[model samples]
Target: MEDINTPSTTGLMDRPAGPDYRLGAIPLAPERFSTWKERLAQWRALRDAPLYLEDGRARAARGAERHAKRRLSVHHATQYGHVFSNKRIPRDVQAAAMGRFEADLIALTPRRVLVLEVKNWSGQLKVAGDRWVQVQRSGAEVTHPNLLAHNREKLRALHRYLAHAGVNIPAERFHQAVIFVNPRLEIDPAIADHPAVLCMDDVGDVLGSGTSLGRHMAARLVQLLTDAETNATLAENLLKVIPPTEVAAATAAIKGLRTWDRLTLRGGRELQGDIIWLRLTGNQAPAAALKPGGAASLEWRRGVIGGIQWVLRNRGAGNLRGDIFWDQHLVPGRRVPLDADDCVYFHEPGEPKPSIIALSHVERLQIG
Candidate 1:
């Protein structure tokens, strides 16, 4: 692992120094176009007499997200991992999915993948059967869907996406929580005692070395993933599922384009060069498939004298499988691999020979 002494990483943790406590936050891209003119709005709209710039609940939600992230960054947690903020499902993946799910934040560690949904609502909150009701200061009441159930669906969708990309981790290894970020919020005792519902101050207890009502919640978290994978392996696999543009944006945020690539090795060595590609091997196939005209005709069946029933049948088909050689590259060239060596080849600007490092030793590769 690379040293955590660098300025870029030191400020991320608020607790006293601990060995191997490395953490990083990936930066998201800013908005591209600001004004309607820049976006080339319709002539009729642009010609309107007055322009409207309003902020409602959206502004409050954004503020709460900022507050939650800030508190999380400084929390005295012993776990080391990367936190992805405002993670959006890629457009291509969303097209085939039923709903547009967005995670407020995703905390990924070797042992646990935690999905956090932050809510900034401030009021007297109560659980009414399957829904939640909020009593505002102005004597107004608002009803909201069950956030706990909604976040659970998001977690399941995330698992589906990862499994589709060949990174199959046990569902037990994933966890979800709904964090109320507003300090002014008041929650009913019945619902606040829930395991998945938490307030801002409870974050450290659930995530790391802290306790909730005499319970070692952090230790309990470890029990959820008895047989966990290595940090590097999970990171590499997760990178495959994440879009390349987002990866590039994260690289730019961590360290500017000072080099073509930054290779962080598990042995604490950092190298600068052009990372051509990564050599990964796996097999992929659809779970099942159907052949053309595989449906059987419907038939009517009669029970002794009770009723008539229609039966529909289908002919099962075989699965189509293929080997996957995913070698993602920084600079484009031949996409296919010529050999089976699982190593990363790095080349300096004017170096005659490329440095070959075994894939297992590399911790992370950041593209410039």
Candidate 2:
């Protein structure tokens, strides 16, 4: 295997054929000249046109903003790579309030959901309640919208939206922070120790340290957020209501679900199943799992069908067959035969304890 960390001088095709060579060469390098020429011409046209100067400036500003966002994303990924991050959540999907209310970044772990409001403004700033007073380089005092308040509202909206969608995430598990992209920006001491606020330099100390949420909780949170069906549902719903322009702006920032093994479970339990549903309790439970009059918990499941057989092992004295249900129904339940193509639902009502079945009437086991 090639050492990815080490730089290679030779191109894939130029390297000598050997057991180490794994990639095949593509013959399209020569064809890319025309595409490059076209891009160069367009760049020259934009540079030469006086009428397009403003457009160029606007494009440059947008490019800088995107670069800053990308840098911040990379930094956070380094600090909390196990966490799931969604950037530029649309106003409608977040708060559904009037005017613009986009969240710059939203990160989720099993322990908490971090809402980060990113600002590139360069100056000294002071936080007062729900407002930020900025002193510009020109010594001019200016007031900008308070990111702390905005992020809090975004978190509130997210919790509400999740609840309405049947994906319960608690308000307490949601955290808010402001990330000043400008390194030179000085923050007032009054807000320096605020738990919700984070400077560009404080990310490593806050997220990477064990003093806050531990790595185990962070990993679990990431797993819940990256669950295939749940992520798809949330994305689909958000895209349905958000504006096209907002979608376009956020497209690059939205990350895909992280991959894991088919039967991977929390606490590193490797069980056999196409779908493994984990009923989490206490602090391990997801925000959605917090139910009234009960300890907060979350049921997380993920996997694809096939290659794994479903069965019911009878612990009773005699052999027997019984009906299987896709979901636990109040009635007798859906009757699914052992040989059917439908999914089998396994219920462990008393979790942390194994379910007892009669020896004669237990699930049959088969590999294929």
Candidate 3:
């Protein structure tokens, strides 16, 4: 817990000493995921096949090379698409190509491989244009396969070099891709038949395909990509649960703290202890109804563009109006008494409240 010194709010009774807040820190472990963790640990162990002569050194060099190439590829991609025509190769273009080049050179990858090539270009494609072309809907043209061809040749060259150094991988298993990064792009008919080229939308599907290389191999691949012992191990260990959705699923369990809670409101006050209801209105501001425990307090902050003027309850019956504030920044939890501009009220389900669309989704507090 910490203190917020908003002392200027009336130097009396230490105003901001209301709530104790702390970030949630949950310790996640592979043991929590049941059988998945063990299964992956076994897979990762297989990646250290000890097939290469200088296994450690080879992995490091390959990772560094790949990282450099990726950097260049991204840089160059930024400069593409314009009428530059690859003239002197703009600085960004050079960077993007370099990244691609490095990606081609890195051979310390695990089993599940994704060969990605990115391109940015605009111009109507055709059924045939020099080396590559393709037909499109509405009878338009696309770009040539020349760009793809160049990338393929480069990849093959790098592959050959690595193979001679003792690494052996089949062509089909390697995977090849030509990415069209440009939002506005056209593919020529020739490129259509080119097994390497793929549209952007399908890229994720393609990358996610295959056996996932289990857990062991994925870790080694991460190692090869990062060129470090710790990162590789960390990436490997995380495979137990894989993260992202897992994190969401794990944390969402906490929301159940208030799942079965209930509350009701009438007029401008609350009848239920757990829930609070009140009506408030003012001259020039947005009106809001709040239940003390349920709807919480009016969260309108001072100096803010808009202010919540009042809390609303069963309207036509009471026409309730009370409390108003002109400011920005809500108090913690928007807590406020009934008198000040920031007051709270409550309402029973389906009760006549404000027509504000957002009011329907309000969270009610729990009180037994």
Q: What is the lDDT of residue 338 in candidate 1?
A: 17
**TM-score, predicted candidate 3 vs. hidden true structure:** 0.27
The global Cα lDDT (0 to 1) of model 3 is 0.33
Residues 1-368 of candidate 3 have per-residue lDDT tens digits of 34555454655765333111111221122222234344233223222111212244334434544443454334322221111111011113325454223232211122222335554444445445455553444456544556565665554644444344333334443345665544455655566556666665554343432224355455545555664445434553565312222122212321111211232221122222212432233222222232212323222212112111221111111112222222322444333322122123333334554221111112233332
Candidates, ranked, TM-score? 1, 2, 3
Quote the positional error of residue 239 for candidate 2 in Å: 32
Whole-model lDDT for model 2 versus the true structure?
A: 0.38
Alpha carbon lDDT of each predicted model: 0.49, 0.38, 0.33
Best by lDDT: 1
| Tens-digit lDDT track of model 2 for 1-368 | 48766545555544322221111221121121234344333233222322102244334434544654555456533333223332323345545354233455555433345666666666798975667899977899888777667678877765554444445444555567776656777888776667767766675443332312343344334436667455434433432211222222223233421111122122222222211221211012122222211211112111111111111121111111221111323324322222111121222322543321111111232110
**Which pairs of residues clash in candidate 1, taking residues 3 or more apart in a chain or in different chains?**
1-266
Across 100-138, the per-residue lDDT of candidate 1 in tens digits comes to: 456787655434556789998877999899999999877
Of 1 and 3, which scores higher on TM-score? Answer: 1
TM-score of 1: 0.43
User: Residue 65 in model 2: shift from native, Å?
Assistant: 5.6
Clashes (backbone N, CA, C under 3 Å), per candidate, total: 1, 21, 60
In terms of lDDT, the poorest run of 10 residues in model 3 is 81-90
The candidate scoring highest on TM-score is 1
lDDT winner between 1 and 2, please give it: 1
